[model samples]
Target: MAALGMADRPITVGAVCVYHEMVSTAVEALKGSHIPVAAVSTGFPAGLSPFHLRLAEIHESVAAGASEIDIVISRRHVLTSNWQALYEEVKAFREACGDAHLKAILATGELGSATKIAKASMVAMMAGADFIKTSTGMEKINATQPTSLIMMRAIRDYYERTGYKIGYKPAGGISTAKDAVQYLVLVKEELGRDWLEPTLFRFGASRLLTDIERQLEHFVTGRYSAAHRHPMG
Candidate 1:
């Protein structure tokens, strides 16, 4: 809701991700509005829950009009080298989303290795993730360039193998316009401009809108605007 009105009053937000219960309210509030509802499902930050519950959460979020579903992969399974089981879990979640876009979250901070990151990226994409995302915003280290490079390379490889162009989303701790631009540059340089649109590129930030507004204000008036609140749409 805040994201919606912010977009109206000079702040442009492509999407707002919320928990499963909040999906319906967000959809209703932002209906006919431009902001897309991206729901965080699949046991989110902890990534420790029963598989059936996670899948049900995905189903409910999609049924509630979520256009995109951000789900965390079971970090435990991935870390244990259970590649086949991990792949099938993601595939099932992808199917559960129905028409909603599926973003498989790697939670890279916990994975702890570039090799693991690369393999996880490949597994998620191959399991039908529309986008392979970085983190859940509940950790200290979320998205880093090296980690992003690994995933981007994995996506490139996947595209080469299957003719599918997967998207990338870097969530958590990306709070500055400079950082956003850097990530954008990374995407453009690594994945090409074809993936620069909101569909393929998104900054999962809680504070990004304000920074963008400040940037836009500078672009228009040559000065920073005072802090303000945008109402729910």
Candidate 2:
């Protein structure tokens, strides 16, 4: 919190993400700040919980003061080509979120193919996802360039058709300053400058921040700081 509350220029994260158990604590700690508390709901990392329980979890998280909910989509729905099921599931999750924004985690690695990833992205957006995320950061093959390209193109297609902009979040494995910059450039090239803001794009890798801070420090002082110097919350 001290790092984010820098007196010279506060560098708040996009959001403080936590499980439902810590939503209240995150909300309290970030009180008076613009950062929203995001809770990972819907069975998280793996969306295999009972259907009703998943929806109930979303409601509970929002009631706990989470302004954003990151819900994992059922990979099985995509794997089996059950687009209707995927759409309905995400739509219900969106409705459960009420006013809170919903970020749908695709778990792309488990989906098996680039085609499935793109299809899942479209269905999630169609079902009213505020953001289509790449992964839960727990998959063995989380966040790769090819998968990101597919999802970005899906977002582009959705925008061209519906004229509604949806956000994109690439989580997992993006832990370096170079990786972060590359993703930023990719977003700019694919989605244009409009998606560059925090409202439309976000990196789910917390470790990436440390590298970014180190790079900034190096640029300013011409010296590299130890990794331990930049602590993550």
Per-candidate Cα lDDT values, in order, are: 0.86, 0.93
lDDT of 2 by residue, 1-233 (tens): 24344558766789999999999999999999989999999999798899999999999999999999999998888889999999999999999999999999999999998889989999999999999999999999889888888999999999999999999999999999999889999999999999998999989999998898888777767888998877862
Candidate 2's TM-score reads 0.95
**Model 1 residue 133 lDDT?**
89
- State TM-scores per candidate: 0.90, 0.95
List residue ranges in candidate 1 displaced over 4 A: 1-12, 228-233
Q: Considering summed lDDT, which 10 consecutive residues are worst modelled in model 2?
A: 1-10
lDDT per residue (tens digit) for residues 47-166 in model 1:
678889999888889889999999898887778888998899999999999899999999999986888899999999989999998998788899888888899989889988999999
Q: Deviation in angstroms for 144 in model 1? A: 1.0
lDDT of 1 at 233: 9
The predictions' CA RMSDs to the true structure, in order, are 4.0, 2.7
Which is the leading candidate under lDDT? 2
